[model samples]
Target chain A: MTDVAVIGFAQAPNVRRTDGTTNGVEMLVPVFQQVLGQTGLAKEQVGFWCSGSSDYLAGRAFSFVSAVDAIGAFPPVMESHVEMDGAWALYEAWVKILTGEASTALAYGFGKSSAGLLRRVLALQLDPYVVAPLWPDSVSIAALQARLGIEAGRWTEEQMAQVAVRSRSAAAGNPAAQLSGTVDVAELLSRPYIADPLRAHDCAPITDGAAAVVLAAGDVAREHCARPAWITGFEHRIDSGSLGARDLLAAPSAAAAGRAAGAGTVDTAELHSPFTHQEILLRGELGLGEQVTVNPSGGPLSGNPMFAAGLARIGSAAAEIMAGRAGRALGHATSGPALQQNLVCVMEAR
Target chain B: MTAPLSAPLEISFDYTRSLGPVLAKFMTALADRRILGSRGSDGRVHVPPAEFDPVSFAPPAELIEVGPEGTVLTWSWTDHPVDGQPLDRPFAWALIRLDGADTGMLHAVDGGSAGQMRTGMRVRPRWAAQTSGQITDIECFEPATQPARQSAAEPAAAAAGQAVAAGQAVAGQVADGAADGAEPVTMIITPVRLGYQHTASTEESRYLRALQDGKIIGQRCPACQKVYVPPRGACPTDGVPTTTDVELPDHGIVTTFCVVNVPFQGQRVATPYVAASILLDGADIAFQHLILGCAPDEVRMGMRVRAVWRPPEDWGTTSENIDHFEPTGEPDAPYESYAHHL
Candidate 1:
């Protein structure tokens, strides 16, 4: 097996709504060109193309099919899709390179979350036959986990407020972030709860966006960029959909995936936490010490773009390793209701 | 131009789910207004029993009477309700561990505001005004003020692990054709309806706009001299966009066709018609359209046809503006001329 590294990455500015359709062709066309141009590669030279999206998110089946026009895939390119986050799509592409399938691959994810009520669509992810009929809004589920942790003394409202504060402060530096600002916990605490024990800031803003990442095998990586963020390890797992059968306050899937991915003692980590309390739960589960810088790209709390947010996490973490700023970094992604599934990827600068 | 318009569209279907045997027994019990739990191969009682144990991957056989009362394991408050939620008003969603059962179930709780609801609070099932095999059979779980009359089917009093001894006592009261705790028998049909504006591609859009002016336009692919009636992003064979515009005659010969004996979803026309793929006089690719003014069996390959337009008022930016194709009254083109198109 050969090593694959991130050679180029690009994303559109996160926004409340994009005039483009939910299929994501309009948004993907320019980014596809930008990332290819950055690496000095043409569309014809790319070896593999894969995407991540969901039918429930777009309110239709085979939603990703029409987007192929952006690539002008008349000759039929080698492609596959996962009804998961784009970070997982990148993981699949990375594995292909490792198995010696192709030297270069492109992975992308796009969602128009603003098209439908996002909270409503998310209900479909729950146990469809047993639980989904009740239609539990996602915020309420997170709040239930938040209150349990608060009662058990695992964390506090003040501590959760601090995570939100630092996320926005770091986000102010990212031009693509839709929401950012320095906020004081005292002022935020005064606000009313959307779900008890959780404030609006504790939740991510509904966003619509697209993102792409380019992966190249061994020599291809060195030729495109001076410093490459070579992948060291990756793993993912899923827990039963029965929310009652498992512990809600902690994520076993994240812990298992992190350990399998060799995520230990990294200089920085990018975690995907749509809710503030999840960040606290995930940090302890992944065994990240206080020294590791987390969410320097503002994370999902500022602008959670559904399918694209997870891939953005990988892109954000790779940026640190590519800039010669970090030696080892970890990128984590989650899906299903209340983090029922998880994935972890570790990369090191070389 | 007209201002764009929109409306709420509900794409729904009953989704006929075939519950082989395990799920059938469960649904039948729900119809009898009873809560039945199935004991899995692992000795765990699962509510709304699963078809197979996820871990053991085997069918569940044992049965237990659970619910009517349970304790909340974890509770979440829904502040902003989404479409199809059990309650439009604010409510608490909880994981309730039913009495006499080993596992828990998820449902809505209506015990007042956020402050009153606690994780360990006791609640009872609130049956719906009507009974069905669906999950909606239980309206919501609410605070149980006092002990209610317990159903005799509940063997909670007979002592635990009495499976062999207790089977005879409960056998008499079992509903006719009920599996007790196996699976439910019901068919739910979920209808899927999706609507799209179905915009034409940039090249096709230009061709349609020109059609409104009664000018037939074709674009010539640079790699191949073949003309494309509706220009494409890339040639299907050579993989390059058409670069030069060319004029073409609409008079084309029928390449091939299939008879419409069966009606299907989203059919725009009546049955007993012919849908033919026509290769225009100079174009390389074929397009699908309806053939009329002839018997279904008479519409043969290489039959010459011409566009039949609908009244002008009904015309818009759509190929449907050309109602159907009618016989040109000219001699049928020779089979040798159009055989390759087939």
Candidate 2:
């Protein structure tokens, strides 16, 4: 099998809102240039291109197609798209490389989540017959999960607040991050609840951003990067869509994906947890010890750009390995409600 | 310098979904002011009935009555409610476990305030004024006034048999109604609406701004030199911005066209009118516009047309500045002139 590795990664500055169109051409253009420049690879040299985005977020159909403009896709290029996060697009690119169909691939994800009422729009993802008809907004749904974990003794509100504090402080180093600063855990708790059991700081801000990662196989990877982050394992798993049926405290899908992707040994981890409690939940589910540095890039609690944030987790993790900051790293992405679906990618420096 | 042009964009549609057998039984029961649960392979009853047995992968064997009242397993308070929620006032969204069911069901609770909501509080259905075969038939849950009765096992068993028989009868009515045309409710229509502030690209904003001044402006792509009107954020072919501005003539040739003989909702133009792809001289792409002032049958590819402006007082930041296009009495351009555009 061809060994795939991440050679380049770049992301747009995470912001509360962007003046750019929903097609993401404005946010994507600079990031695409940055990633290509980092790898010293020409646009034509990319063998495959894939992206992840949503029409629901944009309030229009076929929204992802316009993003192809950033690729200068003239002369026709091999491309595909997923209505999921860019992390899943990277998963597809990995398979494309393994299939020997493409030696170099670029995966990207973007979202102008600010274009619409984000939490309300997410209700469409629930079961149409039963839950969605009630129009349960996303924050209330996460709050239900948070309370479950709190009452079950799996985690506490103070611990959840601590996660937020750490994330914001860590984000101070991430120039592209939307939120950053030192804050007291007591101060975060003193804040009023937007959704009871959840405060404004506990929730990820509505953000507009895009991210791209370049993947290459074997010698193609080495030629472009001085030290490529070799993908040792990549896997994704999903739990039942029925929110009430599964145990919210235990993310079996994240656990299963972690086990399959060999996430146990990573020295650093980046998790896509939109809500603060979710970061705590994922840490337990993935079995990362106290020693394993988590969310060094501040994670999604600081700046979650919807579809792109999940992909950015993978890019951030691989970057740790590529920059020689860590020997092994794990990047995790999640979708659906309350971490119902999860993807884990483990990368290591050779 | 200025922020790109933006406007409110609202999209809405009714999504109709057909419920299969399991949900058909579930919803029909709701119409009668009763809650139903499906028995799984593990002898557990799933509320809002699981269509397929989670473990056995088999369709529900029977749906039993679970709750008109239940216990809240976990609850969260919503300080403010958004549109389309069960209540405009603040409420508690809870996962409730009914008396006879092993699993919980998600719904809203009219708990008044966060202080009143607790993890194990008892609640009951607040039926809608009108009962329809829909989930909203039981509007929202309210705090139960009385403690749930601890009826003996024997009476509960008898009640389960009666509920199962009632469910089968509803299913039977649906089966028979298929022949008689008095169809039971087997489908649900959910009207979904989302609003967005749709922002145009910087290049597009520039073009719209030019239209306000009675000018047709395009940008030339630096890589491919293709002139795009209402300029693109990036050239579709070159993946680069079209930096150089190019002013296009109002007169152009029709690259392609279609005669609208059939009318649609909200259509402004009359039937038998021509909608043409106008390839302005010096522009690489054709934009769709109404081709008027000529017989529909006379509108042809390669025909020369000129823009007809609305009153100058009516001009704004809109393409509507050009009311429509009319045939120019000039000779038709050669086929090769626009064959590449098509």
Candidate 3:
């Protein structure tokens, strides 16, 4: 296995809706070119390519198939796709690198959530025969988890409000963030709930976006960037899909992934928590310390692109290391209902 | 400049699942309006029973009726709904263990609102308007008014195993264990009917409109000099757009061939038919199409085929316009001529 490092990362400005098709070719083509250009690596140079997206999100089956044209896969490329976030796509790419299949790889994820009601499409992830028949909206499901945590005295509504306040404030500087501005936690807390416990601001806005990350082998990494964000550890796991079978307030998958990835200490961390209370839930689950600065790019609350948000989190975390803003960073992604699946990637400047 | 177009689209298909033995019995019991669970040797009554015992890897023998009513072990409120769901309105989704069952079954509960639902609330089955040997036989579960039955046994006809259908027999063998020398069996013909909003890419939409005019258009890749039938943003080889417009004829030849004798899922043609890849003379790639107007066995490699179009009145902006390929009856080219193109 070769020591792979993130050489380049690029993303489109997250928006509430993009006129472009849900296939994400229009949104992703430019970002693919941007990342390749930044690393001076051509698309043909990428030995292996993998993508993460979902059929439900695009309101169609085999949605990723059409995106093949974006790659110009005529002769065909060694590629596979996961019905998951782009973060998992990165995990597959890393696994391919570890197995010595490819030296340079590209991972991407994209989604246009506004094509249909975002929350409604997500319900399809539940057990198809059983729970899926009820059609639970994601916000209501998250609220149920949030209410349990609040009643159990794990966290307060004010604290949840504080997380949103800080995330948006931090996002003010990020040009690509969909929602960003300075606001007091008390003023935000005064707003009415959209799903009882969670305010509109507490939830991630529906966004259309795409993200691309380029990884290279040790020698290729050294040649591409002055400070390559070497992936020190990468691990992921999926818990049971049954919402009733597992604890919602605590993400066992995130904790398992974090411990496996050695996500103990980091100067900066990017967490894909579309809901504010989830940020608190994940922090306690991963056992991150107070020293770790979470969501330096304002995170998913500012603009959450369903399939691409997790990959954007990893890309942003690597960006911090590349820009010399942080020495070590942790990137986390989640999937399924209430963080049923998770992936943690730890990177450091080398 | 005009109002955006929208229409109601429904993608629904009754998937015929071969349940092997365990699930088949379960479905049969459902048809009889009874809930049955199979008990493994370890004494676990699994609802919609497992085909193979998780622990002993043996098929279950004991069948029991756990309950028509069960408590919700855990539940989530559904405020939004998607197409094809049991309820098109808000409801509580839950995992309920029937009175006699060990593992819980997932279904919708008619909680109506978040305030009416709790994790431990009990619910009963709401059978469908008409019964079918499908999961939809049970519409959903609703709040139950009373507890479940406690009988150990009830008067009923003895259960008997029936001869597996030929189609299901192959599926069962494949399910229980991998089989060798299995002639490509047509186990299933799943007609997938997924309706997407099919928004074409900007360039492709333009080409589709041009196709409506009965013209063949090709986009030329500057680097490779290959003209693509449909314009692409990235050339498959160079990963760059095919920048120029070039016209190509609709005629092509058979590059390589495969006789799809074995019937499979979503087959549009009859059994023992030949589905081959035809390379349009000017195009670099070959696509699948049916070889028609000839016996299935008579279709040969390098057999020249041409697009037999439907009547002009039946034309549409789709590849379906070319109904099927018919034998051009030209002399067969030598095998070595197009073997490499394969």
> Could you tell me how far off, in angstroms, the CA of residue B219 lies in candidate 2 after the best superposition?
0.9
Q: By TM-score, who's the top model here?
A: 2
| CA error at residue A324 for candidate 2, angstroms | 0.4
For model 3, the stretches where C-alpha displacement exceeds 4 angstroms are: A16-23, A55-66, A72-77, A112-121, A133-137, A156-158, A182-202, B1-10, B16-80, B93-109, B112-195, B251-313, B324-342
Could you give the TM-score of chain B for each candidate, in order?
0.74, 0.87, 0.62
C-alpha lDDT of all candidate models, in order:
0.76, 0.89, 0.74
How big is the positional error of residue B298 in model 1, measured in Å on the Cα after superposition?
A: 5.7
lDDT of 3 by residue, A1-350 (tens): 57999999999889987766778887877888899999998777888899999887787679898776677676778888988899989989988988998999999999988777677667667654334434456876787777777877898889998998899999998888999998888898888777756788878998999998999989988998888999998999998665654567678889999998888878899999988889998988888889899999999998898889999999999999999999999999988878888999999996
Q: Please give the ranking of all candidate structures by lDDT, highest first, separated by commas.
A: 2, 1, 3
- Select the stronger candidate by DockQ from 1 and 3: 1
Model 3, range B291-332, lDDT digits (tens) per residue? 889988888888888888788787766667777898888887
Compose the digit string of candidate 1's lDDT tens values, residues B31-56.
56678787877677787676678668
Ranking by TM-score: 2, 1, 3
Looking at candidate 2, what is the lDDT of residue A167? 96
Model 1, span A116-177: residue lDDT tens? 77776787778655566555667877877788789889989899999999999999988889
Off by over 4 Å in 2: B146-173, B176-183
- Superposing every Cα of model 2 onto the true structure, what RMSD results? 5.8
> What TM-score would candidate 3 get against the native?
0.77
